[model samples]
Target: MTLDGFAARPLGFVGPLDLSWRDRSAAVEVVGQRITAEVTAIDLDQGLARLSMAATEDSELWAYLKPLRVGATLSGRVVSIERFGVFVALDDGPDHPVHPGVGFITIPELSWRHVERASDVVQVGQRVSCEFLQFDTWQGEARLSLRAAQPDEVPPQPKRL
Candidate 1:
């Protein structure tokens, strides 16, 4: 959430405003040229300051730390199911496919009890809470999970006929 400690620096000029250091890590101006240099120490005499990079290589990490946003809830109905995952329509948000990978909940991750099909546990038209596990910004795709959405319940054993 706080990038304050990361690669902070200041933008200043020794001559004309155009002859100052521009931030290349965040944005680049066509006229101004910024020389990239590692920060050595803070210049207290010259009144230099430190500003965060604003961008990070690990956005997902920050997203994970961010508190659950109010009204960010997406209501989706189960569309299809497989041994590996489930697919759902997340209203107007995005079509989320809950898989079995790092962010998905598979048959194995459902419950300690054995599960055959995801449909058996979740049916079509049944609204379930879907949370983003990981978002692929470039692909416009997100890994979702319903395991947390469903209320905890103890499955009843099959009765003898």
Candidate 2:
């Protein structure tokens, strides 16, 4: 059976996350050059391996993030909520490369107090200040800690046995 236009094929194809798409010029510069990367995952069936390649220097957000020091208090507004984390649009920074915000706080970092959901700690459009934890190279965003910015009460001494 032959089809004239856009027919569905039985064969399936899937590939890596395609690092080249983010930095084409850098990718072109490394043609035939040997480089090492940490394997994140391997799919034998697909004959592919996801690797964490060194691209910090090639990242566009590096210029805005390089000057920042860890633990520095930064302010931003909550832009989104996700099961994994919350996205924050920093008051002063370049737009995020992949996500809607340049700052991100994982669920664990959302608070010192136990919380059920991200919404329980913060809501969208809420202004918040968080301590800079690190630069997330994968998403080109800053890893932030909201709990660090808030004062934590000293724990009471444990009772005698």
Estimate the TM-score of every prediction. 0.38, 0.64
lDDT for each residue of candidate 1 in 1-161, tens digit (9 for 90 to 100): 11234444444322121121223343443443533222223458875533222213233432442333432444566665666766555555422222211223456545444678776777756677765565432222345656545555667879999
Off by over 4 Å in 1: 1-72, 94-105, 109-113, 136-140, 154-161
Every candidate's CA RMSD: 13.0, 11.7
Candidate 1 lDDT: 0.44
Q: Per-residue lDDT for 1-161 in model 2, tens only?
A: 11124344312221233233356446433333444443445668865555544333345566677568998999999999998989999997777656788899999899877778999999999999999999765556789999999887447779999
Residue 144 in candidate 1, Cα distance off native in Å: 2.1
Q: Which ten residues in a row have the lowest lDDT in candidate 2?
A: 9-18
Candidate 2, residue 153: the lDDT equals 43
CA lDDT, candidate 2, residue 62? 60
